[model samples]
Target: MRSSSRLKRAALPRSAPATSAGGSKTDGNHGLIAGTAAKRRTKKEADDAQGPSKPAPKKRRKVIPVKEPEPAASGSEASTQTSHADTKQPEQHLPSLPLDVLYEIFSVLDPHGLIQLTHTCKYLCTVLASRKLDWAWKVARKNSPGLETWDPPKDMSEMRWASLVADTSCSNCGAGGVTSVDFRLRMHLCEQCSKDGLIHSSRLAKAYPDLLPIVRELVPYTNKKLHSNKKSDKYFWIDDLQSMDKKIRKLQAEDPSAVDDFCKERRDLVKSILGRASYLRQWHARYMESRVDFRMDQIAGRFQAIGYQFEDLDNPKFYLHPLVRLDTPLTDAEFAEMREVLQPVLAQIKQQRTKAERSSKVLELYDQYKKTLLPIQRIYVPDDGNFLWKYPKFSALLTRDTSLEITDAEWAEATDALPTYLSRFIEAKRDKHIALMHDRYPAPDAMEFITLAASPQALQHAREETMPHFAGPLELAIATFTHREDTVVRYNRLFTGRELCNSWFEKVKFQFADRESGLVAQMVRMAGLNPRSTTATEMDDLGAQFFCRTCHNTDHERAKAAQEPHTLWACSWRGLLDHFRGSHPTAIKIGLVNHEFYTLERTHNVIDIFENWCCNHCSEEAVAFLPRQAADDHLQAAHGVLTPSVGRDVFFRPPALNVMAPHGIQSYYQFKDSIPPQASLSTKEPSPTS
Candidate 1:
């Protein structure tokens, strides 16, 4: 409010307060004359208050009442005989504070606070509530952090801006639960007011059928508010309809287009408005979200910097509200103070977690050592009773009771240092197994072959590397080796008890130990089953069922170096070993199983016909050997001719088996000197060697 207007607030008449000359209760021409005089006086006072624009101090003003009260009878000339009681009639209520004091107070207060202060008193409310006091509100809006950022709309008065920011009471119901102002409706409303009092634009059109198009043209069908049908539905504020009705009538009176060409103009206007409203809605949404997101980020970041997980902590209603004003979340002094207090507490939690994790590590290592390693040591190596106790650290690890907690340092000393000792023991056990195998089959590379047989990746790797011709028979063995669905049945019913540790050589001999099909008969049977070629005859070695022609898999360099026949057919696992050995040479060298993607797309035509009994030129038998290159070399080097059968692999027919029935899968004579296959689904013990 202007300084001169404020002066009137401090001295307004009790019954005849000065008002606009154009107000409803104006006293005609006389009131207009008085209003003009008052206007002139106000201008003079304003000029005097703001004589210099360069930041000068405001001088205190002594207000003079517009009209003076008549002198009372008890004045200095009162009768001496007048009683003391008559002289002191009731005192008038203390007059409001001087306008200068009110102005100074409003200058320092926030815009919201200034509006609230006006409501507690009558005179101050009238002066501050006037739309003419826009300059006062402009000063007020700058007092608060969030309010200063808002650029008031051109058509909005400072009074409306103040109301939108400071009014907490719902405009529709006077309920004090308003969260924010509805800019479209130009009112502040509570949640219930927003939900129940807001109607879809269709509802407005339905209610006013004759003016539907005009309503659509004027009213914005904003869908900014989210609800169940937010995507396709548009809403209109119900409380705005009355004002809209008045506005429409006013438009009809002033705009000739509304009457001259109603339908088409209204339709065009509606289309234009909808387009503008869509762009405005998008801009408004981005603006609103950016503001809320910025404050939320600040609050979250500040809390997290002090190690507070705000979302993890249940949101408490009392603490969350009031911190945010009109969607601007303010992290005030209290939150900063709370952060300082939490930092030390967060440090304590870190220390405690470190200790707990150390304890968990101790427990986990102890359990793993007990379940897998201890069972094997107890059952197989009986002579090594209490052997672990020989080492002080190992002894300590074994004796520690589960109920007792171990320090991180002590656990690391015992568990970390014991692996080397345990590895030595495992090596000794493997040597014993190797010795037993040598006693039966006697091979220089028996140990390497046994290690490959025990690998976990022996099936899938084998399948991927097999030549397309032999993929069928080899895959049959691979299927049995994996046995995904019936593994328990295969392992327990067939491969258990004393038979689990059988030698590879013994197992191979047992495949033919069925005592039915003779050794030669079994080879013909498996050769017939081989998919590489229908041509079946005799294979040079046991490995004819699966080995790749060019690259041999497994760490079987020892066996190959010794020229051990690439034989021993059990499971298609040879293919997996071939791929592993060729592609993951480092893993094979280190005796490690690599999980990396590896391949072995080697050509094998020469190896397929190395020993098949057919004319080398074009027998299905030649394709079955996988030795296309080797066979070509055999033809070229030894016979001085290139074999037509080098690259092309074609299976013609299976040779008749010696037995009427297919030879037993375990025909022994053919594999007596070789390592046994571990990829079979069946794990029967080898028949007593005879």
Candidate 2:
């Protein structure tokens, strides 16, 4: 009997996808024994062990294709009914199936196969559409690779709900949801059906040897090529090595290079088919990103949830992994050692930082700080970049009661003096640093741009993520106060803020012009702070975004306070990116080449090119950026000379949208597992492997 027909007989309702009881498709007897003819079982006899008897014929339409009322029975209706009731019985006993085994059997079928079997017959459909089955379907769908893409038939939703009411409760869970039984059953159906049922067939073990029947059926095609006058079956895998050797000899005689290229092409085709492995692995990646987006998205709704907006979420990697609770308490001895050995050194370093004259001097102080801060009790790391000497609460710390704190005249003079001093510093080291041109660099007031970029949501949901909103005060304040072109440019250009609006058509640029360095120095002075004294906190969001009263609108404190949320938006160090992109379409597409390179860098090819270029520089500072292994290999292979960028086609592009360690699969897992056990770790290892 045909497989579909056998399945239909086993299931009466024409819904169950596969096998059934005695008369049901699931019946082991439905198929012929190894070498014997299969026999049909009556529905009644199948339902109950009894003598063979045909099932009653279902009523047919009248000759006119219309239904006609049946005439009344001639005999005593009550007595005849009693006799008929006595003749009938429940269904035949079938093999027992435990729930776990059944669920396992159902899990392997892909969604497409499951749908085909569902239309076979009624009795089978009832079991397939049961509530227990629905729950299993849900679990399988959640875990399956491609089944997540399946969508169920619309009518099944209502039927599943109705089925739930008919059943006492689901056999699997003895529970129900808001929906009815049939609806739930249909909703929870498994995606994999054909393979699952085939496995359960009694003959499956014997059929295993002939498992690839589909392939065997194509033997005619295989033999044709093998026997062809000019062609040979060189690419096909043959079990007999002798036969394969013979085929290879024939191919070499026919045309060796043609065979070679054909084999190569076949290998390439195999890899292309395996590409789905690449796609499926990244399936949950976007899901994880969405979770982060959602968390950050809540900032406006509940600001307090943020640990402290001292920075934009800097530890994005750690956040996505499982959260770890550090419950271990420090012992008395540990605490004492920490305080005695570390606290005093930290204090000394802080004092030296206050006295430092330049960044190099501060770098020296940092060395001491790191040494003294061992068994580190408290250390602040900035978000969105840089560090400050103190934690930021800038407006509160710098504000005075009087209106005459720092004069406007003094502010202008300080700003004017900055350009020349910075210019001299840049010229002295012109060859060492990449020149920042006025056309490419950001203007002094670019902090305003950053303030506008900060936004609240995905900026995309599937394809659309909304820009975050931040108010105007924060933008004006940061733009008016910040002096560094790089920081201002980074803040203003890269992000999108929901609040601040700016004209993308107008572009302002700051030129290095041999002046950026001294201007950097004067910038610190004019702000009444020393960069050398700045801690991680000061250089980050707290200092850059909150410190400058002008950025915070402190001069008109009441007016700034009234702006509240908008004020927060204005001073945001990164939000302006969103504003520009939303308000100025031209701004985002303007740097076309940069965007294209970024696409490649994301896949890690860019790093290969970067190491090649930087290897030529040879200077200690120049080589510091390469990954440890790459740099070590370069020194050994390139004779200690830094690789010159002169003839190289590669350039240092910006880092990936989300940067992580660029180690391959096995190394990433090892590195992750090596982290302190108490620290939270992701179940998935970062895979940079192609």
Candidate 3:
């Protein structure tokens, strides 16, 4: 009865109306549900009547709950809420594009941009590597600015050529900073990788003796000579050598007779590769040079936009700047980022250059001023003038604000004023010396409350004798301070340290006393006088008969060989004192008292005393009791009197012995072989001549 009811219900479906739960006819959704059920039943019956093949079940999608619309907000509130919603919206990624669209997009990219795009995702990498996309890579290479003239080799694909040209990382070890491309090997290698992977031709036979001769000839090689005298070594890429070796071995194993054909084909391929590599090498050099020039121009333009000018834009500081050194086109944003660091460096360089230029100008003006002042100095201050620049006033003039503006006329005026500055400088120097002397050697009466004073004559004589000692040390200190060329430091005494001056004075005073005592001892010994009892006047009476043993001995052999007289260096006691002070102040030696020199001097003294002749025409300062012949020569030469009577123009008087040889001795060789009277005399201080 159920089966019959089901069959009857299934058969009654033509435009059937559905009933409600109350058994009344319903007009809305019930009719629609009944019609959809009847249609599904009919389709099932149709599928059951057909053959057994059935479609796979479809997965049901999740149903999301619908949100109802809210009441409209006020205009400002609505905008605020809309903006908040926009801000909270999830980030959207690049949508998948059709291959046609991607190909067009990639076509416009450069090699570097295409390389970067390939690394973004595996999808792009796989798509870019596909054979269909090869046209896009060719377009990219073609559109590249500098590489438009170049194309991939026969064996190299477009993508590979782009990577080889664009990639900066080593293909072997993945190291960065690579700028060179080995197009023959289709690899970018760093210095270290190249070193490790390259096999020199010199080592190739020894390292791989079994490597075929044809394989060696067929491999592309790089010629590099470490030294000029040596022949360039051929370096083959190790991988290329191995690959060719392996290929040759496989060919021999597969077909023993086909090796020659393989070698010929490889030789042709390698020849083409080498020729292409050579051209690429030259192109790479020019391209790198152009790139560097372009980068420098970019840097210069950026600097100029900010009001800076560089005469040498290729200066290492600018050329090596991180942003400027990049192997890419510099963008405005990149320049702006680097400006903060680079601008300060530019400013410093500009300041340094400006300072150097100003210093050069100042030095030029100084040199001109120096030249002008030198002649004036030679005329006015010849005796004691120092370099003009070594004066404080002159240095100040050079460094003054208006120094650069100083004209030739202004310099002339300055030169005229230099004499006055020199006077003040001398005065100041004297005052400083006096002050240092006072500090070093205080006056005896300085501490004595009621000390008796010396006579004016005595005081003046004492000062005259002492002043020269201070002058030497003061000059030494001045020279030491002015050793550098800086004008500011050349003359400033404050910069010349006070302690240095004091130390110099102390040193000079001590050395002077020691040297003077040694000289006095030497003089007394040579004069055969009692050192304890010999007065200054007594020593002076010895006249200028002494010679500096140090100087004479140093030049004795040379002089004797040349037959030249050694008497030229002979001087009186006073002259010897001056010579010692000037030439050998630190050492004191008098010529040994040899009998030959002693007898010669004594004989000359006797002749002068016996003649008793003097020059009466000359003033007291010029008067001298000369020997008869010497007197005649003097009258003729000095007074222009060829003949003068002893009672008239000349007078007779006994004079002290004048041991000075006013004219050099002509008989020096005559006494050269004479024996010393005191052969045992040594450098030891002689016993007081008792």
Candidate 4:
């Protein structure tokens, strides 16, 4: 409110004390009264009594008989006093503080106190509601940490207190309940004492899982308000077990058979998806190795070198890689004829020095031959699939094949047709390859691979390059894929367990009478099934030790090398070795996996033939541009040469198995949240809401 308005309100008159007429006290013992007198009786009192009677008779003319009092005027002081006396006291009241004092009080309050005070009193609530008050609190939180934190050192007192106060209200009867809800005051409240205890704890745990870790840390260290004895370790353990038992009972009561059925369904789906995931990875890997380099070249050439200039000063000429007018040479016969015709115009061309004049002269002479044919250079790879398999049955099958064969047409019927068809087909194939790669590409064990891979420049010094040995199988596997690069490997299950222990295995190595399982095998089993330590150091040590005993011992050079080469360093080696060790020889490094795009497109083709025996449109499209059967036939008919097929298998495909399936999702949207909060209703539904 404005200062003027406040001043006017402060000037308001207060109630006056009640009084009788003539300024005397009123009746009910609240006003003045006259005293009664008796006559004197004595010998000398005859004269004295006569004198007293005479004195009384002389004053009997009455006090009010003098000048009459004037009537009070409406605007006079007397009238104002009378009006004020009639007014009653106000019922509402306010603190006896100046505005500045109130502001100071508001400034001292923390966020929690402000929110509470805002709800408690009308005046305080108004002050808190003001935007200015909000700005003040924001500044305070930013500037004054101590004021904000009630007990900062002790369990992050601000948050702990806020959490306690907020959750203290009883959920059933609310705050009005006989038992005030302050569960945090005690470590665990007995449900027997209050039936709502279990329900409250469950709700609290569900609502505040993020805060649970901090609470769990603090709860064990401090004494609860009411549960000093019950807060011991034994009681806490019993409470936890009891809570788990209660939860189990509740779940069983809700739907025992349904839960079992759901678990079974989940297991089966996981198995199916896991199976598909393997095929997808194998196909993706082959595809990537085939086309990764080509794709990288295109990425580097087109995108990386878009805006650059190169000048050859030594040649003393300005050479432009003309976008429109590329250089072409005329044959001797054509040149002779052109020269003969241009001889007459040469003088005129020279005489005309201005650009416009020369241009006009040249245009007039070449009017009839304005159109020029710039020979369209072949940029795409040549397709030789049909020629390679030209047998009648093979041709028929290959003609239908979209994987290796780019097109079915023997020749282009129109000029535009070739470019359009090639563009569309390449695009379609690239897309297919990319999808296949994503599906097939296995997630690499980056940590392990980086740890193992040969350091840069070390490959040159090494006597034996492991990558080269594997490179052939790896590249062949890569080349096997026509589209998706990642579609090259399949694993039944991802092994996550302990690693082989070098010390234990080494100790058991030459004991003649000792009866222990193969140390390597035992170590592998232990690492796979149960690890001794959770630290990264332990896993790495175990992995390195195992590698030394098995893969490293064969080559002295490899053993001597401080850092392993590309193949040994790869993360896949760790994952695969670990995988094999887990389930004996059931799973091993059957194929390589990669994540690049183009490689996957090529690999997709390989996987289509090798694993799924299906066509991927994306890889097919990419291969179309590179040179397909039709293009190869064109080359035979036109250039009579074919490009190699080694580069055709690189394409990346997306994983086929859904990563979110285990979480009860058919598509990405089903799990809007990390975990589904809503229970499935088709199994069972709550009774219809009346």
Better of 1 and 2 by lDDT: 1
Estimate, for each residue in 212-231, the C-alpha lDDT of model 2 and write its tens digit. Answer: 32222111111112223532
Q: lDDT (0-100) at residue 45 of candidate 3?
A: 86
Residue 133, candidate 1: C-alpha displacement in angstroms: 4.2
User: Candidate 1 lDDT, tens digit per residue, 18-41?
Assistant: 234465543223343456479769
lDDT of 3 by residue, 1-690 (tens): 001111111111111221224635443333434565797798778878775787634744333343553555667777678667656332211223333456678878877778777666545665565444567788887776677777766666677777777666667665667888776665666666666777778787887887777788877876652222433567777767777788888989999899888788878978897778878877886776676667778778878877776653546777777767777666678777888888777766765555455456545544443333311121112232334555554455455553145456755665556645645544454345445421243322111000014454543343233222323333221211212223542122221112223233221321122334445556666677654434443343345366666776676567678977544345455445445655775666665334344334222332333554566444333445556777778878886878764333454343221122222121122233453213323423242232
Better of 3 and 4 by TM-score: 3
Query: Candidate 4, residues 413-531: lDDT per residue as tens digits?
Result: 22223334333333343233223221243322111001113353442222123211211111111111211224332322111111111111111221111111122223434344332
CA error at residue 332 for candidate 3, angstroms: 2.7
Model 1 residue 199 CA deviation (Å) reads 4.1
Cand. 3 TM to true fold:
0.41
Rank ordering of all candidates by TM-score, starting from the highest = 3, 1, 2, 4
lDDT winner: 3
Give lDDT: candidate 2, residue 599. Answer: 19
Least well predicted 10-residue stretch by lDDT in candidate 1:
1-10
Candidate 3 global CA lDDT score: 0.52
**What is the overall TM-score of model 2 with all chains considered together?**
0.17
Best by TM-score: 3
